[model samples]
Target: MKIKLALIVILFGLLTTQAQDKITVAVGTNSTFIETYNKNSWSGNFTLNKAYRLGPTSLKTLKDGVKTSLKWIELNNSYYKTFQKEVCRFKTMEKESFKFHGYVDEFAEEMTMIFYGESDGSFKIEIKPYNSYSIFITFTNLDMLRGFKDLLDGKSANNEIDDIFKK
Candidate 1:
């Protein structure tokens, strides 16, 4: 009986750790990206910059309006944050009245999402592809910023997109 109880406890602990290890990507929020960008483009108020990081081995070029931007970073071994994800997180930090900061996200693929918080409560988007390359956009626009904020608040705006993230 003692051995059986010990085994059960060990199994439960393993299960919990496994659950935490699985990275959750809010892919369903893809529509929020489209809706917000469709209404307006990124504002010139923000400047784009790339932060040096490691992880992915390749990056993919995608359209951000008329300009070509790095859309996805090939996670030679991991995934990076999408452009919008970075914006929302940065905004959160600013809302908290904190300076711009960065936290390591190893779960991200080669290309990671980056946020640069500003003194006035704005951030720049850096789509760092896998390896050392990155695609810089002008900056997130008003609607895009709002959508991103909504995303961080747990409001996916569009249900169809949000459902995609559901297991």
Candidate 2:
């Protein structure tokens, strides 16, 4: 009976382990800043210029059978240049003064990038006005994307990475 019980326990353990379908990574944060990915649903479209600045919001106006794309933001090089441009010459500029913690995969462009800032416990996005926008993403979505990447890369299976997935 003990042998049967042990076998059953082992089988259950394997089943449970197999059932874990998620891959994850750890973005360290100090005690002050709770991981925002744990909360909130982020939705919005964004663009990142070569410099990494957040672009301005845009609008459209049509009249007399004519239409125009109104660009509210202009790309700059002097203030926003850290974020590299993948294509078009127009670049974006911004700073990561330890305000965010997460990552994203621009699969459309075939690349993955991470964003992190010091964990000061304050959720202040230190963004400037009318800067070029690059890679718009919310914390949860970005984390999920990273998780998928980790799964495919076998990062989840490695015991060394297990520590990063802790809640």
Candidate 3:
């Protein structure tokens, strides 16, 4: 009986660690990266230094607009499409004032760990190919994105993963 109990305990421990190792990216998970810019037809040439951080989240409206796309560019990696599952997370950071900051998401797509701290209403993300043109993703929830960038820039660890569906 003693040997059986010990074996069971060991097996359970191993399973727990294995499950943790297979974590999928989602919101509240932080990330960051750096890319250089080259002039494009969409915007004029200019130098802009900015900081990405996750701060307070607030409400905003989504404006209606249409963009003319002259071309479609394919993402470099398909792994993100295969492994990354995007989902919504509801939370109100204890550190932030009791405002319902809303949902966040963390996922790996196109070789980048994306952390959109909070989605106020709407935003956009454009990932440049390994050796391609530079760009930016504009959004209402700037802090959450900033925090994610911090994670990418080594400002935070990417281990803040929690499995809500998996037991």
TM-score of 2: 0.17
Which of the numbered candidates is closest to the native, going by highest TM-score? Answer: 1
Q: What alpha-carbon RMSD in Å does predicted model 3 have with respect to the real structure?
A: 19.6
Runs in model 2 lying further than 4 Å from the true structure: 1-114, 121-132, 136-146, 154-167
lDDT of 1 at 104: 32
lDDT of 1 at 13: 10
* Best model number under lDDT: 1
Which residue ranges in model 1 land beyond 4 Å of their true spot?
Answer: 1-109, 119-121, 136-143, 149-167
The residue-by-residue lDDT of candidate 3 on 58-109, one tens digit each, is 1000000101100000121211222221212212222122123322333111
RMSD of 1: 20.5
On the 0 to 100 scale, the lDDT of residue 155 in model 2 is 45
Tens-place lDDT per residue, model 2, 1-167, is 01111000000011221212221222222111111111112543222221221111110001100110001001221233233221112212221322242122221122122222223321111112223343322222323333333332224544544554442
Q: Candidate 1 — worst ten consecutive residues by lDDT sum?
A: 4-13
Query: What overall lDDT goes with each candidate model?
Result: 0.27, 0.21, 0.22
